[model samples]
Target chain A: MSEVYAARRERLRERCAASGSATALVSRPANVRYLAGAAPRGAVLLLGRGTDLMVCAGPLGAHPDDDRPDEALRIQTLPGAADGRGDPAVAAADLAVADGAESLAVEEHHLTVARHRAIRSVTPRLRLTDLGGAVEQLRVIKDEEEISCLRIGAEIADQALSELLESILVGRTERHLALELERRLVDHGADGPAFATSVGTGPNSGRRGHRPTDRRVEEGDFLSVCLGATYRGYRCEIGRTFVIGTSPADWQIELYDLVFAAQRAGREALIPGAEYRDVDRAARQVLDSAGYGHGLSPLTGHGVGLEIDEDPQLAPAAMGKLDTCVPVTVEPGVHLPGRGGVRIDDTLVVRPEADGGPELLTITTKELLAL
Target chain B: MSEVYAARRERLRERCAASGSATALVSRPANVRYLAGAAPRGAVLLLGRGTDLMVCAGPLGAHPDDDRPDEALRIQTLPGAADGRGDPAVAAADLAVADGAESLAVEEHHLTVARHRAIRSVTPRLRLTDLGGAVEQLRVIKDEEEISCLRIGAEIADQALSELLESILVGRTERHLALELERRLVDHGADGPAFATSVGTGPNSGRRGHRPTDRRVEEGDFLSVCLGATYRGYRCEIGRTFVIGTSPADWQIELYDLVFAAQRAGREALIPGAEYRDVDRAARQVLDSAGYGHGLSPLTGHGVGLEIDEDPQLAPAAMGKLDTCVPVTVEPGVHLPGRGGVRIDDTLVVRPEADGGPELLTITTKELLAL
Candidate 1:
């Protein structure tokens, strides 16, 4: 694992060298974690020129030695770290200047203008270049270890959802159900929820990213839940909509079938060489022709890993093609204003045609389930 | 309430005008919320040049109407909002340009370099000026209404913590306890926890922002728990340390008293006209004299409101002063590396001596309990 992180840093270093940067500072947490193995609170990764350094303000967040960075990376806790006052990015810049580096590349997309100005003020003589989405691009494809973590996270999410289905759900508030799902996710060995658990019932169902409310579930109401787990550092998402009564109504079944088909289309389109937009269109078109075009979310689904939303967004405007080992979510839904709707989502890894195709990670059933 | 939001926006608009800007864009969520009752997901508040607009990507997060922005602020959901595709800030900048504004002030501290660059690209003719924490400065002194929310939130937190103390805690893991406390916070009507709940046991106790571990509670161990609740967008924090089982070691009692005294000093120093650093020094000097000076967190406490950690940081180097209605936490602790330590924290609102000194919001007992 240490070697893996070191190699990752080495690759980034090579990229920086080719880009005319003497050093590179990764201020983005996920990018730092990708190259350093673990990112402590306010930690930043400095790559290039001398020895690689992971400068942290203090100890790691919540979990300590359990998520230690690569052994190969030199951990530099800022002086007076007891107060946790230092910005690791500025410290990295100071180290760069002290090491006599000429230029440093930084993530312009991540660092705020104020922090960027502070960094420049710290190293007035050094030329700071834009690292852009270099690390994000590097993280698009994953190794087996990364995929395994995502798989575990998906399994945890599935377990949490499965447990929710077994027990009584009607008459329960959306907020309570969301909280229960989150607790279950943690119980099943997740660091925490990949994101806030979304539970919508009745009128709120099928709404994308709907915040759980105190609205209680009632008979004949559609219950839509979107949840994910963070295993180790990787994240995966799974969403399912079920009816609250003994049997789903005609509209509920029809809506569920439409959304399930759209989701399946998006999932099936996740081939290694599939264009990101093409995959989105595969799912989007299913609902578009059915007169539900105006009610769709921007994207059909999005890539997930370290962060729940990553690169290779499966949206109409998204560019680039899928690559093997690239994990993404294929979610599609349609919501009516007054009445409820349906959404079926799944996380899958893009695989080649010869290797069976896209590997579905979130294996929760899409078939309409009635509580 | 709508008038209150309008007045806040007017104040900010005047500040921007005084700074020689035609319009101001608030991209920071808290600042937006402060000015516009509720800030929807990916929303930005554009003040001045014309009617204030709260441009949002889509609907409000989770709860819609319950947390809607001020009615006076016109909300413009982006054209393709169904997919949540638009960046509200960029749309805001475009609005500024369309409104014939010659200069636009933006929160440079909140906007990323890439985002700032994108805004410049969109409106090259418009002079882009740095707003630079103008809204945050305005938010420093809370209104009676804002303080009321904080008071309610504090009550919720105190209730949650008090409930946790009554439950049997021995043999329970720090993570489970932390989760349980969070659930209780929600059960007691908190929108959610203000921040991640911190539960430390044994050697982990007394550490600032300690992440809960699987370590179980045992006899003769020091236990520190820090939790907060978010109610009506206001947040409050409270932390207390207790000795596990029916007895405590001499070192534990001694450390707990020291932290308690330091915390009290800090709370007492929260007068309306006191310097922020002086309030910190009040708590810090106590621990400093006890040979635990070097191990203190950057600040003895910090102001809390819409965000858990806000401005008016009570740190040694922080430049600010306590003002009436400003809510802050006075937390102080000492940690023994191998053995458990103690931390005591409370949230209080600064008031004039005439108003009966500092108004403590968290009313939980500070005395060490052997639970």
Candidate 2:
């Protein structure tokens, strides 16, 4: 594992050298974790011309899930800096200059203007270049190990959701339901939820990133929930909408069927070389033709890995094509104001036709379940 | 409530006018929420010359926990824009210029250089000045209503921590304990945890912000737990440590005594008009004189309200004075390498000595409990 991280850093070093940068400072937490194997809070990794240093402000505590750094990387805890204070990015720049490096590349997007100014002030003679989203672009595709983590996370989410279905949920509040699902996720060995557990009920259901409220679930309410689990820093998502009673009404079944068909179309479109927009269109056109176009969310689904929402966004204006080994979610929903709606989401990995097209990670049944 | 938001915006307008800037762009989420009552994802509040507009890339849906915006402020949701594309800060600047504002103040510390350049390009006729934590400074010394929220959040945290202490915690993993505590926080009416829950056992105890792991509790292990709850947007913190066996060892007793004494001294020092450094020294010197100087966390405590860690930081070199009604956490701990340690933390409001200085919000017992 240490060798993998070191090799990734070496590849990044090679790219920087080709660009004429003497050194590189990785400030973004995910990127730092990708190349350094560990990302302690307020820690920065400096890929100097000779040695690599992980400068941290706080104690080098270990997370239960992630990989620890190998012995090759030097870990230096800075003096006098507290947890969440004293920008480590500036310290990296200062270290670069002290090492006699003439040029440095920083992640301009993540560093604020004030911190950038401070870095420049400390090393006035050093030339700074934009690293842009180089690390993010590097992380678009995943190794088999990374995919394994996401796969397990998806399974945990599936188990949690399935358990919630078997239990009685009609009278519970959205907040309690969300909390219970989160607890179940942990019980199933997930490090935590990929993001905040979203539980939207009735008119609130099927909304993107809906926060749970104290509103009780009524008999005819549309209870839509979107949740995911994080396993070893990798995240996967699953969303489903259900009716609160023994039998869903005609309108409820119709809405659920519409969303289910749209979600199926999106999943079917996930091929090795399919364009991201094409996948989105497969899902979005169904809802749009049904006259639910105006209030649609920006994206149908997004790539999921280290970050819950990553690149390869499935939207109308999004560019780029899906590749084998890339994991993504295809979620589509339509919400009718005053009334309610349905949302169905699943996490899948893009694969070749020879490999059964897309590998569905979240294997929960799409059939609407009534509590 | 709407009038209060409007009045806060009016005060900010007055400040901008005196600085010779006719408008201000608030890009920071907390700042936007402070003035506009609600800040949707990727939303920016523009205090225009004639009107205020929340510039967002999409329609503002109902957020789960945050308060909705006042009807007085106009919401301008952009159409056809890609999700997560187009900076709202730049859009706010363009709106300000279109509204015929001559100058604009931007949060330089929050906005990136790329967005700053785009803002400059869109409004070439306008002069941009640094807003520079101006909104954060305004947020300092919160109103009575805001303090009430913090008080309630503190109570929720207290309830969660107390419940965890009564459970059979001798053999549970640190990760499970942390998750259970967070679930209880929501059960007690917190929107969610103010921050991630931390549970440390054995050598990991007493460390500030220690991430919970899979380590199971053992006999004679010193178990320390820190947790918080966020009510509305107000956040408060509480931390306590306990002995695992029937009775604590002599080392555990001594360490707990030292930390308790330091935390009390820090709370007593939180008088109105007292220097921030004085309050930190009141607690820090106790730990320093005990020959545990080098490894202590930099700041004894920090202000807590809408944000867990806000202004009025109590540190050795920190500048500024403690103002009345500014709630803060006075947490001080020492961790031994091989042997475990103790950490005691609480939330208290700064008050005048004549009026019973420092109102404690976290009422959990500080005694070394043997579970």
Candidate 3:
């Protein structure tokens, strides 16, 4: 495990050196956690000229969840950072200059302008360069170990959703149901919900990222739920739409079938070397041809990993190809204002056609069940 | 309500004019919400030459929680922003240039370097100035309505904590307890938990902002829980520690008593016009004199409002004076590594001596109850 982190840092260092930077500062929490085994709050990883250092505001040991740094790497705690005076990134840049590094690469997208200015003021001679999304790019493809975490997270989410299906959902407020799903996820051994559990009912159904409200579940209404779980830092997402009555309305059935077919098309497009946009179009065209494309969500799906949302977005304008071992969600939905809609989503890993194709991690049936 | 937002924007406009920036762009969500009465995701407020405008990625009405913009303000949605191509801040800057504003002020502390650069590239002639923490300063003193929201949120938190005290808790894990508390808060009509609820047991007890873990309660362990609720966009915090068994160990009783005294002193120091550092010192001195100051947390407390952690942090090096109606938490805790510790926190509003002193919002007793 320690060697895995060290190898990742070495890869980042080689990339920085290739880009003419002798040092790279990783302040983004996820990126820091990727290079170093752990990322304590306000902690930054500085790949210096001679050695890599994890600069933290306080002792990392105090945080139980933050993974300890690889023994090969050094840890430095600023004297007053615990009192909020010290910034780990600035301290890392100062260390980079002290180590005789001429150029430092930082994630300009993550660090605020003021923090960047502070870094420049502290090291006037050191040239600052943009690290950009190099770490995020590296995180796109996952090893089997990473996939295992996602699989477990998906299982936890599936279990939670299954339990919710068995309970009496009618008359329950969207807020309570969402909370119950989250609790069940934790009960089934998840760190927490990957993101907020979205439970949209009635007119709120099929809305992407809809926050749970006090609206109660009612007969003949569309009930859509989108939730995920985080297990050991890896996140997986799953969404399904169901009917709340004994028999669904004609529009509800039609919308559910259309969304299910679209989601299936999107999921089936998850082959290695497929263009991200093509995969999105596979699902999008189904909905577009059905005349529900005007207010469709931006993307059919997106890559997921340590972060709930990551790289390789499946959208019309997205510029990337799916690779083997990349985990992504294939969610497609259509919502009509004042009426409900449907969305079916799943997390799967891309694989070569010869190898059994995509491995579906979230296996909850999307049959539009009527309770 | 709309007039209040317009008045807040007017005050910001006056400040920007005084600072020589003809136009101000507010991108920080809380500041935008404060000035515009709504802050949809990826939205930026531009106090343009002609009128203040909110630029968002999607229709603001689609989001249920986002407050409607003041009727006097205009709203513009970029064509491709919903699909992730457009950035509201950059578009606002471009609009500022088009509106004939020679100079623009932005929240440099909130904007990323890449974003600031993009804004500059799009509007090369516009002189970009730092808005600094001007909006945050304006938000430091809450109006009566804002204070009322915090008061209600505190009452909800107290209700949730009281309910938890009556439940069986001999062997429950920290995570379950935290989740239960959050569910209860929502049951009591909170929009949601202000922040992640913290529940630490035994050795994990009394750590500030400690993430709940799988550790279960034991016979003589110290249990500490910290939670808050957000009501109508206002947030408040409360924390308390209790003994697990019928009788606490001699050391546990002594430590709990000392922490209670320190917390009481901190609460007593929340009078109007008090220096922020003095409030922190009042709490620190109690624990410091008892030889437990070596590993104390950075700050004694901090202000809470729209965001859980906001302005007016009460720390040793903090420079500010508390004003009337400023809601803050005086949370002082001591963690003794393997032995566990105690923390007592409450949200209170500062008031003049003539007005009967500070108003305590979280009314849960400080007494150490053996559950």
Which residue segments of model 1 deviate by more than 4 Å? A59-66, A81-86, B59-66, B81-86
Alpha-carbon TM-score of each model against the true structure: 0.97, 0.96, 0.99
Error of 1 at A254 (Å): 1.1
Q: Compared with the true structure, what per-residue lDDT tens digits does model 1 show for residues A32-104?
A: 9999888776789888687999898875544353578888888888776545356788889999889989899
Residues A1-371 of candidate 3: C-alpha lDDT, one tens digit per residue: 88888888888888888989878999999888878877788999999767789999987766556467777889998886887797999999999988888889999999999999999999999999999999999999998989999999999999999999999989999999999999999999998999999999999998899889999999988999999999988999999999998988888888888998899899898999999999999999999999988989989999999899899899999998999999999999999988878888899999898999999999999887997
Instruction: Highest lDDT: give the candidate number.
Output: 3
RMSD (Å) of each candidate, 1 decimal: 1.9, 2.1, 1.2
Sorted by TM-score, highest first, which candidate order results? 3, 1, 2
Using Cα atoms, each model's DockQ against the true complex is 0.65, 0.61, 0.75
Error of 2 at A241 (Å): 2.1
Query: Candidate 1 on B1-371: residue-level lDDT in tens?
Result: 88998888888888887889969999999998899988777789988677999898875544353587887888888877545365788888998889889989999889999989888898899898899989888988899998998888889988888888889988999989999999999988999999999999998998888878789998888899999999999999999999988778787778888888998889888888899899999999999999998756778898899999888889888877788988889998888777868888898988899989999999999888899
Question: Model 1, A171: alpha-carbon shift in Å?
Answer: 1.4
Model 1 alpha-carbon miss at residue B160, Å: 1.5
User: What is candidate 2's TM-score against the reference?
Assistant: 0.96
Candidate 2: residue pairs that collide: none
Which residue pairs come into collision in candidate 1? A62-B211, A83-B298, A211-B62, A297-B83, A298-B83
